[model samples]
Target: MLTPVTDIDGAPFWEYAAQGELRVQACADCGELRFPPRPCCPHCQSFASEWRRMSGQGRVWSYSVPHPPLLPEYAARAPYNVVVVELADAPRIRLVGNLVRAAGDPLDSLDPRGVRIGQRVRVVFDPATGLPQWVLERA
Candidate 1:
């Protein structure tokens, strides 16, 4: 159970996650997509924006296995993976999410030896929570 900071700007992202979708901020003025869900697009500085759903597919741009939990809340889940994934649909945008599977189901468990930089992955919604998360996509 990861706890996220939901603020005015980022609330919609989490809300969409609750609905099993990843919604990014797309600037109505320039059609450029942005992450972290801000009010204005950095490219055009336009306040006009809309929510765009992603394909939920991506590749591991970068990854790390925490020897110790970076946050107190994750102390119990130490040695977990945190990956920066470049979404397939949104080529220029990347997202950060937990690589996990359902309880009692060992599907795509994070392996230190198996995971490498640039591995292909896809978004997987946690069946229990119905939240949009990520998992390794088997080739």
Candidate 2:
């Protein structure tokens, strides 16, 4: 269940992730960027869309360390950091991911206590999973 579930609308996002590129859908008709890759643009309701590349640099907008009784699949990785990152290229487009010491590192590898809001981070794709993970820019 941890694997991303892809549909026609979201397939491009996952496809880009697999290629180690961070991209978000944009309204082809109006040039408005959007996340969660949908068919219709929330800005203009246009069905035409395109995927725009992102800088993969962002600030830690928020984060949390979940307690027990979480999803059974993720319970073993307790005390992990789940962060919402506000993209430097698109402030309104935020992505959720883990803050790791390095690309491909385990979700809980970094101590949750070390994470904080407004910290600078860069995106790194997990070699095995291709999922986007965050790492402290200073580190």
Given candidate 2, what's the lDDT at residue 62? 98
- For each candidate, what is the lDDT? 0.74, 0.92
Compare the candidates by lDDT and give the number of the best one. 2
The list of candidate 2 runs beyond 4 A from truth reads: none
Residue 124, candidate 1: alpha-carbon lDDT: 70
What is candidate 2's lDDT per residue for 12-113, written digit by digit as tens? 898999999999999999999998788899999999998999989999999999978988888898989999999999999999999999998988899999
The stretch of ten residues in a row with the least summed lDDT in candidate 2 is 1-10
Off by over 4 Å in 1: 69-76, 102-108, 127-131
Residue clash pairs of candidate 2 = none
**Per-candidate TM-score against the hidden true structure:** 0.82, 0.94
Task: Give the Å error, residue 108, model 2.
Answer: 0.8
Candidate 1, position 6, lDDT = 81
